[model samples]
Target: MILKSPFPAANRFVTIQATMNKTNPSKKQVVVIGGGVIGVCTAYFLSKKGAAVTLIEQSSIACAASGKAGGFLALDWCDGGALSSLARTSFNLHRSLAQELNGKEAYGYRPLNTLSLSVTESENPSRGRKQTLPDWIDGPVKSQRTIGTTETTAQVHPQLFTRKLVETAVAEYGVKVVIGKVKSVETGGGKVTAVVDGGGVIDGDAVVLALGPWSSKFTLLSSVINVHGVKAHSLVLEPRDKDAISAHALFLSYQQAHGGQPMDPEIYPRPTGEVYVCGMSSQEDIPDDPEQIEPNPDSIRVLKRVAGTVSSHLGEQSQVKAEQACFLPCTDDNVPVIGEIPGMKGCYVATGHSCWGILNGPATGAAMAELVMDGCSAIVDLTRFSPARFVKRRR
Candidate 1:
């Protein structure tokens, strides 16, 4: 478990709000647990909407999947599915946010020309047909096709983006950051309290459980629905000719020499002059702590091979920036479970976006704030993502 990244922490009641406890008697006090993008965004929007927000985390911000995962965004990738509206709404919101937050300079926000390609490591580069792929992609390319244009695709530095939201929320919106793990959510009378691991209790009018993959570890949530963690690996590489790597994002069907099974790896070139490659995934027991998570060496090695097979610039000449693993939260139904928890008024859970967490973070946060503060969300329809859908199945 690594405690640090190229990124970076907070304390309880750290912000100077109107009051030591509630901040403002006129505003709704909302406590959001988990400091991942989902939770941070929730806190951001809640505070932006005039709610007194307190965000609690066990470790540094973006230390888990939020920081480790590749930050790819698409407008219609979730089209024809339950996530279509949410994805679209979030896509648009990301654009507006980029303009408002100086996202290009703050968090590496930019539109991308995305592609899908097939590469065989053993195949001779000269034996293949002339590829119309980007020049930097000088490898054993077998086939290529344009999957996404700049109009419908974009990306961000996930860790940077998440951290930026938190910074804005704290500096401008009066959102408090608490550095502690939430033990449980308890409701007595009409108020809700978040019990922290160190005996700290945060009182709030409402509470959101954005525990990511750890949502399953909570009995109150696990009893209603399961949030399983899928361990995924990624590597950040700084190529020798960073300028040569375009802003194109690649979705590849990669095969090594004497192939066993073709691997589906994805690549994204960042504005920070580095490229990200990710692929190898498996399911294993999620550890009790995010800090306990570690990438499998074999998976890391295979990802390196895949990166080299995709482009020479990312081959031996490239420097590895990060080799890490994080667990993506996924549900059995394959749709994110949002909205309030049944029978527990003012208690909500938002998790299980899987790989789309970064793409969908803004809308999720906006929708959650609307739902929590206005009694329903106008940002996007939350009907399909309700946790009650599973509660009905449980019945």
Candidate 2:
């Protein structure tokens, strides 16, 4: 059987890596830029495939969206769309990765039930649990329905999950981690080099750019793909009765007492006994630095109010553990760009995952590994997600 690739010209590394793996003593070297879930996953899978990998990051691992976003995984939420196969593939991969990495202990991985409900804050909170809600959801909740179950919906502490992948990639596969702000890429002389702001260069047989929302900041990608950021805010609450919280993720349509527009916030309970509530997302200009991204006071206030209105345990009695925000990378066509850059052989790109980054990280990484090393991805078809489509639009 022969392998097929959408990136025909860019498969130079395929033969080089194959020849090197066969006769040359040294393994193929791959430089992966970005430290978010996508980049970390790519590096992890690349190293697993025997590539000598170096992961470059502008900040600490999982310090941005990967760290802050609600780690909600839905096997079918993205079904009936282009991401259906990818979501299903990654959901299973998460399960296997959990077993291999002891994810439950290391990253708070667990299956949970997901619900969609409507809540209208009243002057008085309900004292009794209704509609089979866990006793703690004392808010004026109604119209509750199960959207997902343990078999299909699950989660991981996103920050810990990304870090765990990095740790495993380093300890088990000898992948190196580099801290730097990548300024540009050099594709001259048959090698790809990542030039850092301070004049540091990391060269490799191939390179994968997973810059998340920062993809637009990189001229190489922005020249072809239109990647933008959506700023989203979230808050974490530590309820006094931790045990009262069950592994139930909630999708809420909330209307405050003085209602204007209904708000859609999501709630996820971590195994470590913290409840994370996130909403209030909008398209915004991304800051030059991730650390500089802070939550809007109004958005934070609204989310805090939503938490209290949803559950008394999460109301004034709960501890405000974290109030933060991050940007979700979106694309012009609302699909991820995940193939070799049209004309840059031995250089690839992966971004524009939007809100599905964490849910799809593992499979994305695995497919990228296969695409970079094996010349094709058996994990998922890359035809629909090829960057060439966007390039074609430009013609």
Candidate 3:
């Protein structure tokens, strides 16, 4: 079942044209840099709003964290902070998109139950009886607590969802995807005129830098926004009897038998018959190239060992399908930097999402489109997330 387009052509064109006429601008040409979830979603929303969008990528679409991430979605997980509103808005958009994309089956979208587990030194079997756990989790589970219910939490196959958004934008609208590494942004008359890459210059009326951690590498942007990367390692495993595994996400705080520090590993059993486990963050320097990102052998070994202790099905090393690592973008304060830069007219940025990039991609895109066309976001209030905050502190 194919999902219907939420933004009909006639309505989109009318709405965008009406907004553009207010500024007396010609056709809206938007150039989005990066092909991760954030960039693709920005391009998708712009196209939905009847803007001419060109998405430029150094590598293939979703080739980094957007593809490798464990696509866990939570509505209230990020509450009690500045991110509360943004997280809530994005969670709702995800629910709507699941239906608009022909239901959860299409993109591996589904509600999940989440639990928190802690390991203990005591091997007494009575320790396991204090909390309820699925029969499949047959290891050193000392304590378990339900953290989220199905109504509040969900999951998606990150790569599939990212690719779908770009595909839909291309087929339904006329959005363009260009393959090239953006070298720099060309500015004139106090506004961005075009993006210069290896191939050639792609002109645009507006430019968005959404290059994840790689955004910092561009001197033009690094001088303005302070974004860095936190490297993480993960593994995808295929269980022998996938049906036996329950649809529950596990956040395990493990105590290694011979260890000093406790290792926290997360396990998510996907609808696609695969289990994803991730933990172990490193302060390693960000690579200049996305393809150069590599997983530490020790990290992988530790993860494999943790998986074996988590569940019987995941114990088989032969079931391991992929072992990988990627860098998640972060800011000094940990809040995302999303909005137009103060000095760089027509230049916008949407990165530093860290682990929540995939979960909040759609809302960020929608808000960005509104900011670009209507001069402010009509959906979510982005005053606190403006890139100007970083620029002001530097002065």
Candidate achieving the largest TM-score: 1
Predicted model with the maximum lDDT? 1
Better of 1 and 3 by TM-score: 1
TM-score of 2: 0.92
Per-candidate TM-score against the hidden true structure: 0.95, 0.92, 0.91
**Candidate ranking (lDDT, best to worst):** 1, 2, 3
**The CA-based lDDT of model 1 is what?**
0.87
RMSD of each: 3.4, 7.3, 6.6
Q: CA lDDT of 241 in candidate 2?
A: 96
Query: Which stretches of model 3 miss by more than 4 angstroms?
Result: 1-26, 120-126
lDDT of 1 at 216: 91
Displacement of the residue 98 alpha carbon in candidate 1, Å: 0.5
Angstrom error of the Cα, residue 371, model 1: value is 0.4
Better of 2 and 3 by lDDT: 2
lDDT (10s digit) by residue, model 2, range 158-181: 999998999898888877776667
